[model samples]
Target: MPRWPYLLCFLLICGLAQAQSLYLHSPQGPLRGGVNEALGVGYFLGIPYAQAERWKAPLPASGWTAVREARYFGNACPQRGVFTTRLGGYLPPQSEDCLNLNVWMPLAAPPAGGWSVMVWIHGGSFTGGGSGEPVYDGSRLAAGGAVVVSLNYRLGPLGWLTLPALQAEDPQGSVGNYGLLDQLEALRWVQRNIRAFGGNPQNVTVFGQSAGGMSVCDLLASPKSGGLIHKAIVMSGGCTFVRKLEEDFTFGAEWAQAMGCPGADLACLRQVPLSQMYPPEGSVLANVVQRVEAGGFERSPWKPHLDGAVLDKVPLQALKEGRAAGIPLLAGGTQQELWGELLSAPGDWTSFEVRAEKVLAGKGKAARALYQRLYPERPREAWAYFQTERTLLCPSLEAARVQGEWALSYGYLVSYRSSVFPDLGSFHGIELPLLFGTQNTWPAQAIFLSAQAYEDSLPISRELQRRWLEFARVGEPGWLPYDSGKLLEMGSELKITDNPYQERCGLFR
Candidate 1:
């Protein structure tokens, strides 16, 4: 027994040394990455945290006896137009097994305390984004003093597919929300192995914009996601896109039936070519029901569903009932023209006005009157711009109110009129470049919204980054929790302002 104990101790020491060693096995073949001193970070990209059989749900990665090559980005999950290479520049490639994540650890050998963790979920309307986006480089955030991570999860049809048969066949008996499941799995990965990367498994903040923000809301409301994260930062989209279980499930079933299999037929759905499963278009679908699914409330196109497993209820209800985990939450929306550029390509201003009315009606009459008074001189083209507040800003502000009393709730209004489109004022998606502080990388319309030539917004970007870094380390972003009386304004200036209470925005409370 004494001899066996000695042997065990010797083996444990060897394994520890081997576990700390790093290597690479990229598809392009072997390569090496090392620790950076200036950035004070070490990054290992393309680490696999989960796996899936072809056309099947993701499974825990096969355990390996040896240290794994976490060096290369695995092939991205298959879906329609997930190919970011077409989004213009800096997009990598795509694939069917893209279950991977990237890590950024402090450059130092060992810090006194485990580094704080910030896991960013990239947003591309839930259909077309990945961790591979260049702007998502984790080194900057990690070097700023936390273990920053960005990851890839299944997206689009491959993710939210819901069918009765799939549910029937479910090992967990849950339907739809596979992409969300993938996120939960990633969080599980962080909880289980992040200590190896110098991250405190217990402390984490999940942050994202647009669809990623929507995902954050889903997770926040999900029972399955209860203790995985300590805080959340929701950028643009949140609590807006709601779905029904039957509608999504029925749609999945019809698609399967059209493929010659009928009745709760998940087997057939899984076998179909992914492209055939989810057709692609050069557009982002809003919460509006489609012409096909419009007839019934049950049919929603490619969004999270009201399945009882992961998401038990919608965000607003969950918040009111106090089902939320009560984690500190920081959420905000960009100022005017939020969805303008995205909607401009094909639609007319009248159609845009119709969208505005729908969003306002949902917000309430008080918001409508206040919005009209604020934008009394609304230009024909600018109609869409004002709608941004109704559709996004006010809604998010109200959500901040809910968390303000119980948890630290900080809100900011992105009001710096973009230097690029100084004429248009601040526009939609303006927060992206600003948050990443990558103003130099703007595209055509995005360029118009840049703060480049103008010197005023420079300090704002720096300050915002500082606050974000502070949030990454400590829960508060160094501001008073937004309250009914005072709200934080994140513009060319940061100050307290009266909450917008006289409009549809009031319905949120």
Candidate 2:
């Protein structure tokens, strides 16, 4: 036996294990990808799903003859560093040509048709976030007997800007939903290419957290998104308040004036740099909230609005009217939501009242009185619960209730708290670590849990992943529909609970 032959065999085996190359013809074009034999998964990274023309609807990915490399992650859609930094810097370099998607599939080939598919839409309030974030790695989820896909869409002013000049450019006179159109384009891409990656396009599940979750609701409501997605899991995103493209130009006018552009000057607006679209230095969060309080729906000039074309009505209204896509829904929220901020001083009833009054606004007197009556001596707990119930819990319950009229809707309240940041409770987005199974990662540790806490959360994380994957596989996570407005509280223990803020929600209703 020749040593040369032995060396050649070793090299081949090593190549197969380290970077097993795979080539496939997809609807867009032939793509090249790598496989992780150790994990028993195949990875196709940074494949362009669509192309965008600034603020216009996205076009399908251009076909290619040569095998396009999908080894590295795609460029993140252009957004301010401040936003990503606030999120603990999980996003990648920004680019306008960032409408890319990634795929993960089991090493084994699909059976008759294909494996069930889970498409992820990252959330950053419709202004930030991309598919390339480290937490969104789909390998672990894909390894569990499914194919997973994550995609990027436009954000901020580039994605959601509305102007008469831009609308004039549109033959259909529809604008302001370019980011949503990007999502639709990605789903269409999945229908075309996912089968090649061992995924069943017919049984697709669209899942996302925060703004991504809101996107899921929008997809469910929009007539255009019908049949593109089969099931939806909306985490930490509410559907109660939907805004219209209000004729009042408080934001649009201010933004245009700041950019030295007229309300109708699309070209002039386009020339303004990406950095200019962000709020003034160190005031992103405050400015955004202030603007939103001032009657704008977004911190930036971007956010989903009831565009007559893509979104004809509010999602809740659509669901009520049975105009939304009749798809199974799993809507959930965290136990704390913005409760962490309120819990810092337990006995500060004055601060609590002030904050509570501000949060309740028009209904402040009623909410304050009800909250004070419910937990008179426990202002801290009351404030925390008030934050959770009003923003996350009640909205989710209400959304589920409306969805029940047209589809099977399940509601969950994540109450698992972190041993590291115990006060944080099940704060907003706490489920990301558990859901992504990234509790051990440095980013997750820094923001979400301590090492010990992460270890402690492993079981819950695994269970959460299992439940989500199960739901993706079969439109149910072994839970009953929330027809009666009962929800599963996912905490140290799982039990059914009536809407926590049914009375408070009644005020809104």
Q: Which candidate gets the maximum lDDT versus the true structure?
A: 2
What does candidate 2's lDDT look like per residue over 1-509, in tens digits? 23443244324433544447866556677667787767777788999888887778888877888879987898999875434457575677788889999998887645555678999999887777788877777877888878999999888777777766666788777777888899999999998877667677889999988788888888888878877888888887767444567642456656676566755477787777766565444575436534543543333446776778888888878878887547788888887787764637447566676776676677766766887888888887887787777766667667777878888888888888776667667777777877777665546666444566656777777777788888888888877788665777777656678756568767655
How far residue 281's Cα lies from its native spot in candidate 1, in Å, is 5.0
Candidate 2 segments exceeding 4 Å error: 1-20, 82-84, 247-250, 278-301, 343-362, 447-451, 493-501
Each prediction's TM-score versus the true structure: 0.81, 0.88
lDDT (CA) per prediction? 0.64, 0.75
Instruction: Return the top candidate by TM-score.
Output: 2
Output the worst ten-in-a-row residue range by lDDT, candidate 2. 1-10
Encode model 1's per-residue lDDT on 1-509: one tens digit a residue. Answer: 12343244324423433334343333233323444445555677777778865335677665554446554555655544433345563554676678888887765433444678888888776767788766666766777677887888877667777776667677767767788888888898888777656677777989887778778878888888878988888787666566788766666665456555677455665576654444444333322113333442113466777778777788756765666646888888776635444445224434444555564455444443444566554434344545565556665666677766567787877776765556655655666665665555524235534345445556776677778878767788877777746655677667677655435455433
How many pairs of residues in model 1 come into backbone collision?
15
